[model samples]
Target: MVTGQAVQLDSRSAWQRMRHWAFAHAVDDFYQGLVPASIPFFVLERDYSYVAASGLALAATLGSSLPQPILGVIADRWRMLWLAPAGLAVAGIGAGLAGLAPSYPLVWLLLLLSGIGIAAFHPAAGRDARRAAGDSATAMSLFAAGGSVGFFLAPAVATPALVSLGVGATALFIPPAVLMGFVLWRFQQRQSRNPVAAKHSGGRDRWVPFLVLTAVAVVRSVISGGIATFLALYWINHLGASQALGGAALTVFFVGGVAGTLTGGRLADRLGVLRTIQIGSVAAIPALVALRATPDPWLGLLAAAAVGVAMNIPFAVLVKLGQDYLPNRPGTAAGVTLGLAVSAGGAFVPILGILADHSGPQAVLTALCFVPLAAVALGLLLADPSAE
Candidate 1:
């Protein structure tokens, strides 16, 4: 039997809750890991051209992007209680089929399916998490931390699978998705049995914060995309760093993000959400600037960590902020935070890629620094829930 009425969790229980939450977040890694470990190898093994080989990842992102905002609205409106679970199931099934697909088009179709699966899960998962946390920063920290854990595990899970099953076959390893779905299904059933509480009013005026948050977050996302996409290349090309060291730098950044996110959430709860995001955004300015001028790999890695800490936390906080603004629209806020924020980064990819080509990654990153700085400015003016 499923249950609701807001899960009350202390630190220990919060961790336990997050374990389930993290399982849902891990869905990204399940497919993401395939890019390097399995998909590329499959291309080589199958003698597919570069264009054909790239379809899976490309199609997947596009597919996932399509439904998020719409689905988020649905989630906000109190429809599709089973959406998250069904989404995960779709992703898992898509992965399974992707492995078995014989042609490039088939792979594209499968990846699209997987993307839709991802799109389906995030809004509900995020909204549910926020509700469960009851505005506790620590609880939200636990919630956001699950994504990092998933990201951390992706390579570990997919790498071995790639070695054994080939890229396409590695999709079979995502067991957590199925289990999570079953559990979520149960929870939804319970949620249905008991009528939900009247949600907070999501109003037209909320657009002010929403737009500012989305705009600033997108800028941050661009900076992040620049770093994530090109940092290794930058290190190798400019600093003569080894590939391993570059990878380590990336890992350090992600670790920083995980730590920063948790810290940001806790701090936000205590200091106020806008204040926390403002501080994190300010903290990031120096980090991004330093990353470019520093010559040492160790220093670069340290800076990457700083970026991670600030980058990850702000969005999680923004989700919280969205919830604050749209008490009636947790699902919508969740969707914006998870789907739209990420998409913002994606939207910048082409332009940033062009900038990287014409100028260099440093220039792109330098340009990208303005995002969080803008966020800091916007955050300063933000009215809190108490103010409302």
Candidate 2:
């Protein structure tokens, strides 16, 4: 009876920690989602060219991607609990300033700063999330699903604000970041005082397999980043849809991503991580092809949702699998899987934007159709790290 009670209490505690981390994850990623959602407005309001807009994305990508592995190393060596909360504050301030900046250079810098905050947040937060959730894929999924939920809400939140209040409305988004940051700061301080050692499934890092996984993840990222960057433009420019409808399309995709992330975690537990990734990779190709081929805007929206599910079905599984591949360097694994590999796709969006400049958004999206095939091939090369 006592053992049962203790187990129940631990479960409850674990859930509470997961909820806190998930909420922080949502708030941090909200800024990330905001970047893509806001790009259309930049084009419309500032008369920015597609290449210039993609440069903005590149700035964010560079800031987020370059320093993440270093930050992960720092987190591992120092156990920097404060980084999670501090990063939220920095991200919010940077995003808020981005809209208010007068020059393109200033705007680029602000977004870059925001990206750095995002980079800082993920490694430490993900490491803690793993600790909080232990080995439960479902619990880890719940935490990861928060980012998808944030991405889903970004259009819902930003579209209305941008439409009504203009870019300056980003200032209004800062309070929640401040509030969440403060709460998390206190939470981390308390946790540090009573730090619980994380259990490890001792193993050597498998660099070869991990590199293959990173490659697959990078391909997945390109598909995802390309879709987010161009989906609204496709709807508005190609389909002659309203701005609101374009936002709706992006929201639909993110909603499907939420569903996929949650389902992937459960499937990883039932099947295996490698199998789940392979299945998602295989499924994505058809969905993206259908999305590219559809003429009707409404059909395209449904296809977008399908693409989201197919692409994101391996989201949480990748993070878990990377950790398994490098149990000793879990922070480095999380940094690469969650940050560098994921953001690498965004770094290439400018080339896609160059394509969009000449070939139209459809052409750019059509190119994405073949990316998942590459990911599928890479997925086949990855053996289940746990099996070894």
- Residue 259 lDDT (model 2): 89
lDDT by residue (tens digit), candidate 1, 323-359: 6766666776777777667645655555665666677
Among all candidates shown, the one with the greatest TM-score: 2
User: Taking the tens digit of each residue's C-alpha lDDT, what string does model 2 give over 1-388?
Assistant: 0000000114455457589888998898888888888888888889989888898888888888999889878766667778889888888888877888888999999999998998998888877777777777777788888888888888888998888878777777888888999999999998878866544556677989999999999999999999999999999998888888898889899989998998898999899898999999999989999888888888788998998898989999998888778777767777888888989989889999999999888888989988888998899999777676
| Superposed Cα RMSD, model 1 | 4.6
Candidate 2 has its poorest 10 consecutive residues by lDDT at 1-10
For all predicted structures, in order, the TM-scores are: 0.79, 0.95
- Worst lDDT run of 10 residues, candidate 1, spans 1-10
lDDT of each: 0.66, 0.85
